[model samples]
Target: MLGRMGRPGLIGLAARTAVVAGTATAVSGGIASHQANKANQAAEAQAWEAQQQQAAMNAAAAQAVAAQQAAAPAPQATAGGGSDLMAQLNQLAQLHAQGILSDEEFAAGKAKLLA
Candidate 1:
């Protein structure tokens, strides 16, 4: 029954403190790193979802445009006045001159008008 003291030595206390501080620092750093990784993953997932939503919207808009074009009514022509036909031909000629329509396209338009 021969023991030293009520408290540990100064060097023993310093060693213990260092061990505790180091362990605390290491655990806190690990937790912070984990949280950052989780946040990064969440942000990336949000960005990916946004991109998918944008793509879907773009597709829907394109479909809407196609549908609108398909549902549009053709111009009505005057039977004997020939005014409407001339206007249509003039429009085709203008489109061809603007390079919006090719030579074959202009020919097709002219044929359709005459027919």
Candidate 2:
């Protein structure tokens, strides 16, 4: 048989359903937020690793350039008066004084002057 108070019973049922649905939504949103935070942290870690790799590559490139410069011979000075070599030596000294050239460069240039 049909219930005597049908409308009130239906309304109460609808309200209870709405409350259960809201609770489920809140729980799902919490889980989604947690997942998003984890993804962000992983991305940040990857970015940091990439930066470190790039820094290492840059250091290696600089070392290679220094090695090449060291291996190459210095230009021969002009035979007229030894003035060209003297000028180059003076310039090297100035660079050393200004902290532009390292000790290795100064020594190499000086050795070239003697030879």
lDDT (0 to 1) per candidate = 0.77, 0.77
> Per-candidate TM vs. native?
0.60, 0.56
lDDT (C-alpha) at residue 91 in model 1: 70
Model 1 TM-score is 0.60
Q: Write the per-residue lDDT of candidate 1 for residues 4-100, one digit (tens) a residue.
A: 7789889989999999999999999999999999999999999999999988866665565446436756667656858867877787688668765
Whole-model lDDT, model 1: 0.77
Candidate 2 on 4-87: residue-level lDDT in tens? 664557778899999999999999999999999999999999999999998886666556546755775666655685786677
Considering summed lDDT, which 10 consecutive residues are worst modelled in model 2?
A: 60-69
List candidate 1 segments past 4 Å from native: 1-6, 74-115
lDDT of 2 at 5: 67
Clashing pairs in 2: none
Clashing pairs in 1: none
Error at 12, model 1, angstroms:
0.8
